[model samples]
Target: MIDKTTQPALQRLRLNLRQLEVFLATARGGSTRAAADRVARSQSAASTALAELEAALGCELFDRIGRRLQLNENGRALLPRAQAIVDQAFEAQDLFLGEHAATLRVGASFTIGEYLLPGLVSRWTQLHPRSLIQLRIGNTSEVLDAVAAMDVDIGFVEGSQTHPDLVMQSWGHDEIVVIAAPGHALAQQCATPQQLSQATWVVREHGSGTRQVTDEWLLGHLEQVRIGFELGSNEAIKRVVAASDGLGCLSRHAVEQSIADGHLIELATHLPKARRKLAIVLHREKKLGRGASDFLAHCRAAAAF
Candidate 1:
C-alpha cells in the first residue's frame, strides 16, 4: 500500500441518516417522544440525534414552543431535501429487495376511504402481494394537511380545495345525491325547491368535503336550508337519515348500497345534478418513489375505467 498516513484525510460526513430521520419525525410529530416512537428509538436518543443534527448544521432547526417542536426557518428549508434523501435511501433498499417489498403511505378523505378505495386497494394488493400499504382516513382538509406535512406520500380527496404546497391532479368525479328515509314525506314525490329548503337535513361536519359541496349545491338552489344534524361518519349520517325525517346529501358511492337495500331513498328533486371532482394530491416538492409512482399510475388507470 502507498503511504496511507501521509495522504490528506477524507472529510468525515457530519450528518447521518439517523439524525435526519429523527429530525423529520420531530418536525412532523412536534415532540421528541413522538419522534422516538416513530423511529423506534428512545426519547433521549432522538433528542440527542436532533441536537447533533442542529450542531452539525450550525443552526437550530426547531423552535422550542413549550412542549412542542415547531419547525423554524432552518428546519423548513431542510425538510424537502431531507425527505428526498431519506426516500431515496429507502428506494435504494427496495431496489435490492424487489419492487413488491416497497411500502406506500396514503391519506384519503372520508368518502374515498370508506367507499372508493377498498376495491382499488384490494386489486393493488393482489398485484403487489408483498407490498405494504398504510392508509390513513380523514376528512379532506386533514388529508390535505397530511400531504403538506410530508406525513403521507399521496392523498386522495374530494372538493376543490387548494393548498399552496401541493399539486392536485384530477383523478375522477363523483355524484352527490340527496336522500331521505323511505317514510319521509319528500321520498315519494318530486320535491320543489321550497319544500326541500323547508326540510330538516342531516349533513357532514363543516370541515368535510361533502359538507362543502352540499352547502354550495343546496344554497345555490334553495334560498336557505334547515339544519337538523351534523355528523362525521358517512355511515352515521346514512343511519341517522334512514331513521329520521332528515334529508341527507352524500356521495353516490356512500349511499347507493343503502338505497338498494331500502334503508334510504333517493329524493326526486327539481334541483340540478351535483357532481364533485375527485383529486390526487401530493407535496409539490416531493420526489415520489417507485411504490408511490406505481400506485399513482394504478389510480389513473382505474379512473380511466
Candidate 2:
C-alpha cells in the first residue's frame, strides 16, 4: 500500500476544484473532447486537469478505450464525493449571500412535475421573487430516493409507498381514467374486464406511480391484458393511445386535453373509482428551512387539503 500521508505538498496543491470539475465533466461526458466543451476549456486544458487529478491521487480513474473513456471503480467512488463538495461549496456561498438567496431543491414524480408543479412554482415565484427553486423530475421511486437522501428539500409523489425515513402528508387526490382513441372498439361503451383484456393497451413504465396504481386496480382484475407498449413519458403514452386502437389508464389531468381535442375518449370502466392520493414527502428529521416551509404552505393551500 502507498503511504498517502507522506505525499508532497505540491501534489496536494495541484488537486484543486478545477481538476475536480474537469474530472467530473470527463466522467459524465464519457470523452475528454465533450468534457472540454462542457467546461468551456480547450481540449488540452481539460486533459491536463484530468491528468493532474489522476496523478495527484496516484491512480487511473478511467479506462481509455479507443475514443471513449469509461469510469473505473475509483472514478465511480469519487463521483458522489466530488458532487457533494461542489454542492456544499455553492451552499456555503449562498449562506454568505443571505437566506433569501437559499434554494429549495424539489423533486416531483412525472405527473406532478410535468403538469401540476409548473403552476405551483410560478405562483410561488410570484409570491417570493427572491427565492430560488431547483426542480428535478422523475418517476415516483426517484422522487422518494431524492427525499430520503435529502437531495431535495421536498418531494411530491403519487405512489402508495410509505417510508419510515420520510414524513408523508396527503397533498390531494387525483383520478385515474381509462382512455382510448375515438375509434377504439370500447370507446363508446362501458368496458368489461374481458373486453378490455382483449384490446391492446399502451401503458407507463413499471416504476411510475400511475403504473403501480393501474397494476393494482386495473390489471388485478384483467390479468391477461394485452400490453402493446410500455412508454416512459405520459405524453408519449397519450399520443400512442390517441393514434392507435390501444387503451390506456392515465391520470385524468394527463388525458384531459386530448379528450377535449377529440384525439382521445375517456372510457367507462366496470370497476370502482380509480382515485389515489398525491403526497408531499420529506426527510423525517430535516428541519424546515424558510423556503421549504413557504413552498409546503403554498402546496397545501393550492391543494386545499
Candidate 3:
C-alpha cells in the first residue's frame, strides 16, 4: 500500500472532479448503461470516462465480466478514499462557486430525527439564516456508517458506535423503556425481573438500536422470554402494542407523544432502568463547516437527555 502520508499529494496527480464523478456514477449504478442513464451521457462516454479515470490513476478500477464492469479489488480499496475526496470536493464547492462555505449536512437516525431535531435545526437556522442545513434521516446503524464513510458531515444517533474512524460525543442520555397499551393489565402492577421475564414481548426488527439494548438487557436473564413479534419503525411497533397484549422496547423520547395521548404505558416497577447514551459522531479526519459547528453547539447546549 502507498504510504498514507504521501497519498494526498499523489492523489492530486490523478484526481479530477469529472473523472471521480464518472467513477462514482459507475460504482453506484453498477453498469455503464445504468451510469449513462444517470449521468445522461452515452454508454461510450461513460466507458471512456472510466478508462480515462483508470489510466490517470495508473490502475484498473474495475474488471469486465461478461458485459458488466465489476469493481476489482483495487477499485474496492479505493472506493472509500475516492468517495471521501468526492464528498470533500462537493463540500468545498460552497467556498467559491455557488453559496458561501456555510452549509451544513447533518445526518440523524429516526428517533432523534423525528423527536429531537426539528427545534435544534430551527434554532440554528434562526441564528444563522444564511447557512443552509440539510438533514438526512435513517436507521441508527446506517447513520453511523454514513458518518464513518464521510457521506455526511455529522450524525446524531441513539446508541454508541465503535468504529475507529469515528470520534463519538455524548450528546445526551436516553432509556429503552418497555411500553404497552395504557390500560394493559401490567401497566399498574409491579414487575420483578422474574415476572417481567414471563411476559411475551413485541420487539423491533433487527438492526434497531432499541432492540440491541433490549437484547443486551436480557443477556444474563430471560433466556426463555418469548419475542411475540418483530417489526420495523416505532409507529408500527406502537400500533401493534396499542391494539394487542404485547409489549415492546422504545426510546423514551420517541413515545412521549403517544404516552401522553394515553396510547402506551411503562412496564411496572423499579426494575433497573436500562439507560442508553444519545451521541453525536463525526469522521475522525473530516473538517467541519461553520454551519455544522454551529448546529452541533446548539445541540450540546439545548438538547436534554
lDDT of 1 by residue, 85-173 (tens): 99998888888887758679999999999988888899999999888999999999999999999999999999999999999999999
Q: Provide the lowest-lDDT 10-residue window in model 1.
A: 4-13
Query: lDDT score, residue 89, model 1?
Result: 88
| List of clashing residue pairs for candidate 3 | none
Give TM-scores for every candidate, taking all chains together and pairing residue i with residue i: 0.95, 0.70, 0.81
Q: Score candidate 3 by TM-score against the native.
A: 0.81
Candidate with best lDDT: 1
In the order shown, the candidates' Cα RMSDs to the true structure are: 2.3, 6.6, 5.4
TM-score of 2: 0.70
lDDT of 3 by residue, 193-225 (tens): 776677778887777677778788765456466
Give the range where candidate 2 is weakest over 10 consecutive residues by summed lDDT: 83-92
State each model's CA lDDT, in order. Answer: 0.92, 0.84, 0.78
What is the alpha-carbon lDDT of model 1 when measured against the actual structure?
A: 0.92
Arrange candidates by lDDT, highest first: which order?
1, 2, 3
Q: Candidate 3: minimum summed lDDT over ten consecutive residues — where?
A: 94-103
RMSD of candidate 3 to the true fold?
5.4
* lDDT computed for candidate 3: 0.78
Could you give candidate 2's per-residue lDDT for residues 1-305 as a string of tens digits? Answer: 75877677546575688888888788768888998998899999999999989998999999999999998989867766675565566566777776657788899999999888999899988887878999999999889977765567799999697777798888998989999889987877898888877888888998899999988877678858788899999999988988888888899888888899998899988878888999999777666655678788888888742
